[model samples]
Target: MPVTEPIRVGRDTKEELRRLKVHPRETYDDVIRRLIDVYRKCQQ
Candidate 1:
């Protein structure tokens, strides 16, 4: 089994991630992964 870790973020940062979500129920992990992919594409 994979180990999961807890992370803490500021309320404002959480709100920002909420806004970045593609769907209402999208997880923060998905949102950050999508953002990282986009950034990597731009850097290439």
Candidate 2:
């Protein structure tokens, strides 16, 4: 398992992440990872 670190975000950013979820049970980690993968692909 990866070591987890806590980070802070504005309430608005948190709401945006919630809206970006594909499913209710998905974790923030999963959403962020998906976004990072998309960004890396675009950069390439």
27: Cα error in model 2, Å: 0.4
Check candidate 1 and list the clashing pairs: none
Q: Give per-residue CA lDDT, model 2, range 1-44, as digits (tens).
A: 99999989999999999999999999998899999999999999
The candidate that wins on TM-score is 2
Q: lDDT of candidate 2?
A: 0.95
List of clashing residue pairs for candidate 2? none
Worst 10 residues of 2 by lDDT: 26-35
Residue-pair clashes per candidate, as listed?
0, 0
Candidate 1 per-residue lDDT, tens place, 1-44, comes to 75767899999999999999989999898898899999999999
C-alpha TM-score for every candidate: 0.82, 0.89
- Residue 24 lDDT in model 2? 100
Instruction: Determine the C-alpha RMSD for candidate 2 after optimal superposition of all C-alphas.
Output: 1.1
